[model samples]
Target: MTFVTSEPYIGHMGLGGIGDSKGLLESELRKRHIKWVDNARVTSVDQDKVNVEQLDEKGRVANTHELPFAYSMLIPPFAGVDAVQGIEGLVNPGGFILIDKHQRNPKWPNILAAGVCVAIPPSRPPRCLPAHRRPD
Candidate 1:
């Protein structure tokens, strides 16, 4: 489980606690003779076994190993949008949804974007010399 804290003061404590909890859980599992693999990245999986690449503490690929598990949870990295060919008047040239100054679509004034992936205009003009020189 991942615990995320945005508060400046609690951020450090929350991350430290997560690390400590994971270590304690692993230690307890080891005591019960349960085998555990750390830094094993899944490359692929077949019907019986999964191909994994082991990484060193520095995150460099050191060796490859295959392991069998009754069940596994696989999480994939987030991929960006592909070519927006069929869509018309919805996406910008960069494949991102475009919005106006009030975060409303220019073509569809009723549509408003308010989420993590929503695109917003830069608060200031781009390429302005010395970041502080830009108007707020």
Candidate 2:
């Protein structure tokens, strides 16, 4: 089996609390004979298939191909409350509020956020790790 990741190392989402020792986990994955494709990303998806782009050493797309599957599902990314869209620097590119450890917007100190209001990107397989995920 193969697992692909855009990161040079796995565990950025800290799955199973393994982010701190990503290299070790990667070694274990290799010992199990699983092919780990790093620096690769999914470009598109459709029922029965996914389109992937393999990046070059410099992280530019070097090649693209299909990865076929029998199942698929999808969940969209979270966004900030409609009240905050297009406002100046209040949110990230994904439209979710940016927060500090206290969950307060640094610029708008009065503002606070958590859960869906803040974007915590999913760990793997992309798009919240749906058992079967399709592209938006």
Candidate 3:
């Protein structure tokens, strides 16, 4: 079975368009007799199966089930870096810990950064920009 996370923006694109696209995709899969599931979240996965939790109208977990598949692909939610404290000159004002151009922290050279923690400087800027505006 295939699973898809429903994004809220899909509604703005028109429900009929979304439903028709889904219907076409489903029809193609149905021709191959492949089952599918939507609006279900994967809670955990093991070597042989994945545990899924079904959500209700209020976004509460209503039920759980295990599904076995020969192949699977998962796309997780995005989030910022972890909070860092007790370190001087190591974190940016925006809560993403600071790093140099090489992705190494200035204060802690051994530390490297990825994800949202890596800061990108603005292309156009005043010489004396505020601390909040600078990429650091």
Give Cα-based local distance difference scores for all models: 0.53, 0.66, 0.60
Question: lDDT of candidate 3 vs native?
Answer: 0.60
- Residue pairs in steric clash, candidate 3? none
Candidate 2: lDDT of 90?
A: 78
Clashes of 1: 0
lDDT of 3 by residue, 1-136 (tens): 6554533222212122444565676677788776654456787899989888766645677677788878888865532355664345776554566778888888888998887655554343432346577554
Residue 127's lDDT in candidate 2: 30
**Which parts of model 2 have CA positions greater than 4 angstroms off?**
14-19, 44-49, 63-85, 115-136
Task: Identify the superior model by TM-score, candidate 2 or candidate 3.
Answer: 2
- Tell me the TM-score of model 1: 0.39
Stretches of model 3 off by over 4 angstroms after superposition: 4-19, 77-136
Write down the TM-score for model 3. 0.43
Query: After TM-score superposition, what is the CA distance of residue 127 in candidate 3 from its true location, in Å?
Result: 49
Model 1 / residue 118 / CA error / Å: 16
Give the TM-scores of the predictions, in the order they appear. 0.39, 0.55, 0.43
lDDT of 2 at 129: 34
